[model samples]
Target: MYTLYIANKNYSSWSLRPWIMMRELELLFEEKLMPFGNGSNWDSFRKFAPAGKVPCLHDGESVMWDSLAIIEYLADRHRGVWPEDAKAKIWARCAAAEMHSGFTNLRSTCPMHVGLRIRLKAISPELQAELDRLNELWCEGLNRFGGPFLAGEKFTAVDAFFAPVVFRIQTYGLSMNTQASAYVKRMLALPTMQQWQTEALREKWREQGHEKAVLAAGDVLEDKRMQP
Candidate 1:
């Protein structure tokens, strides 16, 4: 059995990537939740992950850190984690790579918080530019693939990679284009997504200094499609 070391499911966006992929693939594993930055055994996580980060994967003796690397590793070991078509594979790789490298502004500004929401004081000009670029990326993916997912009919690694971004867009109360909004809706409808949301709602750990920024009192939107 594989062992996945993750932070609180509520705020760990990177953690979600592999967890969702594993759930979607139906891979059985044990999950160890370590609250981010501080907790009872926070320092011990570094022994498992070189970078002292959560979302570390332990497969027997081998250890893989970083979300995208984990996804690629899993796909290498478990073939269908990503789509198999030649073109779909290429575009999926591109989408994942772009997400892995870009979006600094969005990430820095709108961190992922499961039970929290924060309205931005000012959507930075750079962040707005990044949003435009993301809109273009989503539009391109939708135009090429048509309906449902980024790479057309199937939800590939590309979708998994962008999944957190969808959450961030909503969490920060960010605006979206038609394609982006549609994609967010589709992601919200995933059973795995609803499962995560439900679990997050039940978690009680709260990181002190980060709480105000992460979870805003007024940002709770209407309960839409997530499973409870």
Candidate 2:
């Protein structure tokens, strides 16, 4: 059995990546939720996660501290972590890797807040460049590999990597090209996505740090979260 450590679904974008991938892969595992604590969770998370990050995976005595590492670890042991087709597998890895490292602007400007619908005051140039790249990359994958998942017919790691972006788009009501929009709709419609959002809404703990980013991004139109 594997144990996965995570943080708040509403705010932890990195945590969502592997957490959703594991669920979609139907890999049996236990989830440990450690919501962001007051001040830094650095000391606390360092207990189980080496670098004090969520989405840490414990496979018996061995531990994988990074999301991409865990994804690859599962890919080694599981059958469908990445696409099986040669070209598709290559593309999936590259796309997922790109997502792992790139898109800093989107990640920072539009932090994941699943329970709120926000209307942004403005999209900064940095964010706009990233968004343009995002749409282009997504369209390239969908056109080359065929949809409803990036890199193929299956919802593999690439889709999981972009899952948080789906929520961000939903939160800020961001626009994309037609194909990318359809991809977002498809991803949002996933059963796993629905489950993740529902749990996120039910969470009442509001970490001020995450809230600060939300306010910086835009006006909160609707908050689906439970009231205090």
Candidate 3:
């Protein structure tokens, strides 16, 4: 079985993808939790990954870093990580890439933290524009694909790619159109996602200042609070 090295379950968004994908695909793998923040954890993570990142997959002797690479590698080993339809496959790739490479403001402003909650304020106008574009993307994908997910029916890698975004959206209680809200609901309903969240909720590990994002969701952020 493949071995996955990951950071804290509560805050590591990248760690969630392939970890959950493996479960959804029903592929058995060994899970090693390296929980971030300790010097030793960084040392171990860097030893396995040249980039010193979490969610590193050890396939026998070969190690792969980055969530998308891990997902693609597993998809190669087992099908159904991506869509079966050719056209849908292309769009799925596009959506995944867009999610992987873009969304700077959303990521920077809203770090993923599972259990804690806080209020936020004074979001940048630029970030608000980014959020608007993201809403449009979510709306279009749901409309075209007829989704409870981004690519419609099945929970493909595309969904995994944006799962972190889903958490961010929910945590922030970001305003979304009907379609986007429905898509968020679909993602939340996934068994694998529930498992991830359950694990996250039970985590004792904490990151300084990340609690605010989680708390922000349930509470109202003042108009002046912003992450600098």
Which of the numbered candidates is closest to the native, going by highest TM-score? Answer: 2
Per-residue CA lDDT of candidate 2, range 1-228, in tens?
A: 999999999899889989999999898999999999978999999999999989799999999988899999998999988988899889888988898999998888888899999999999899999889999989988988887789889999999999999999999999999999999999999999999999999998999989998999889999989987
Query: In candidate 1, which residue pairs get closer than 3 Å at backbone N, Cα or C atoms, i.e. clash?
Result: 116-215, 117-216
RMSD of each: 3.5, 0.9, 4.7
Residue 56 alpha-carbon offset, candidate 2, angstroms = 0.6
Q: Estimated TM-score per prediction?
A: 0.88, 0.98, 0.87
Sorting all predicted structures by lDDT, with the top scorer first, yields: 2, 1, 3
List per-prediction Cα lDDT, in the order shown.
0.80, 0.92, 0.77
Q: Which is the leading candidate under lDDT?
A: 2
Off by over 4 Å in 2: none
- CA displacement after TM-score superposition, residue 128 of candidate 1 (Å): 0.7
Q: Could you give me the TM-score of model 1 versus the true structure?
A: 0.88
lDDT of 3 by residue, 1-228 (tens): 899988787789999888877888898899998877644455667877878888899999888999889988987888899988787778888888888898887887778865544345656787788878878877777677777667777888988888887877766667777777777887888888888887787776665545554554346443222222
